[model samples]
Target: MKQVLVLGAHGQIAQIVTKNLLAEDVQQKLFLRSSARLTVANPQKEKLIEGNALSLFDLQQAMEGVDIVYANLAGNVVESAKNVIAAMKAKGVKRLIWISTLGIYDEVPGEYGKWNHEQLDGGYLETYAEAAQLIEDSDLDYTIIRPAWLDNQDEVSYELTRKGEAFKGTEVSRKSIADLVTKIIGEPSLYVRESLGVNKPNTDGNKPAWYR
Candidate 1:
């Protein structure tokens, strides 16, 4: 049985992933800055640890006895990834599933390219790109998932692009992203050392439709 540690467990996508993990009978450990952020029902039943991801001591403590690390974190993501890498190395945890964004690699095409770059260039894209690079270059077994603009739609459907491939469509559901994360957890070998771009098929447009 794989023991999964979810960083940023209160994030929308991470919450969905946690529910799915519970259903699959996997051991779960949740790390968040505060217990108040956890809205998941019966959070106390899981191994919920309160700590900052940027702190190595906190991460070291939370990562104990963990098999896989699912990083669905935001804000200073680059620094967070570095800490995760170091902590995982110390803990001897080998698998990492990292959540990233499409625009970080300039993979979107046509007008959407302009829009994505303009929207994320100075802030999110730069930080995410740096984080992605760090993860890819690390010795740990890692899969970097780049999902398009996240939506709250309940359906779990999506498309994928391999590393260096042009991203497809836009506006994948948060459920879809969670499903992918769940799948990766179940099969650690799948997409290892790979970066995937996930989006909704047939939803291609200049920017996500929701932004219009």
Candidate 2:
């Protein structure tokens, strides 16, 4: 059984994915800035590591013995990507599942595309795109997951788009992204060195429903 290190363990999606992994054969090293806030479900199976993604030392510590890394992070993502790649190289961990946002490639189409820019333009979209570029340029087996506008709906419904293909639909449940993460963890060979755009099947709109 391979151990999986989950960065940004405090995030909503990370927490959901961590909980899902708990039931599987994988041992989890949950890494975050503050560890005390996270309650370990299985003491023997989950190890809460207190650390920040921006620190290479902390990331290396968490990467110790981790076979796969699932990073669900926010804030200064470009620096985070650099530190993550450095730490993984140092620790010789290959596989990475990174959470990113839509429109990074300007792949979103039509009215929804314009709306996406309206919401995520300026610093947010640009920095994420830079971070993603760093990952793609790395030698690691990385799967970059770009999910559509997220919601808390309790369903797993999503479709995927390759890097060059235009993005599809509008909104997708957080559960859907988590399910994809769970699936990739179960089988590391699922989407290696690929960028995937995840969205709901029929959610095409100018923007997410809550905003419209």
Candidate 3:
């Protein structure tokens, strides 16, 4: 059984992933800034640890004996990515699934691309891009997931586009990303060392449906 460590465990998708993994055979260590935010329902399959991603020491301590790291983080992400990489190296753990936003690579084309920039440029997109580049430059097996505009729908329906391809659709359910993460955790060999763009099928528009 692989020992998985989840950083940013308080995130919506991470919480969903935790619920999904509970049914599986893997063990999970959920690391959050305030561990009190989450409860561990299964003592055998799950452990909740308090740690900040910006602290390399905290990360190294949390990463001990872990095989896979799923980082679903936001804010000061570049520093966090650096700390995660360094800590993972210290603990000799590979295999990372990094959650990043779409438009980081300017991969969304046409009017939606322009609109995305209007929504994310100046700071968010640039920082996420830098963080992803740092991850790419690292030697560890990493799969960076760039999710299109996310909704809280209960459905799991998504498509994937690889790096260098124009991104598809305008939005995807957060549950879809969770499903993909769970799938990757089940078979760690899938999509290794690649960046994936995730979105729902045939939802293309100048903006997401809700936004329109």
Query: What is the clash count for each candidate, in the order shown?
Result: 0, 0, 0
Local lDDT at 114 for model 2: 96
Q: Candidate 3: where is the Cα deviation over 4 Å?
A: none
Off by over 4 Å in 2: none
Which 10 consecutive residues of model 3 have the lowest summed lDDT? 203-212
- Give the Å shift of residue 24 in candidate 2: 0.8
Model 1's C-alpha root-mean-square deviation from the true structure amounts to 1.4
Q: Give the C-alpha miss distance for residue 178 in model 3, angstroms.
A: 0.1
Query: Residue-wise lDDT of candidate 3 within 122-184, one digit each (tens)?
Result: 989999999999999999999999999999998999999999999999999999999999999
The lDDT-based order of candidates, best leading, equals 3, 2, 1
User: Per-residue CA lDDT of candidate 2, range 110-196, in tens?
Assistant: 999998999999899999999999999999999999999999999989999999999999999999999999999999999999999
lDDT of 1 by residue, 1-212 (tens): 67899999999999999998877758888889997777555554477789999899999999899989999999989899999999999999999999999977788889988888988887789999999999999999999999998899889889899988998997899999999999999988999999999998999898788875
- Candidate 1 or 3, higher lDDT? 3
TM-score of each: 0.96, 0.99, 0.99
lDDT of each: 0.90, 0.95, 0.96
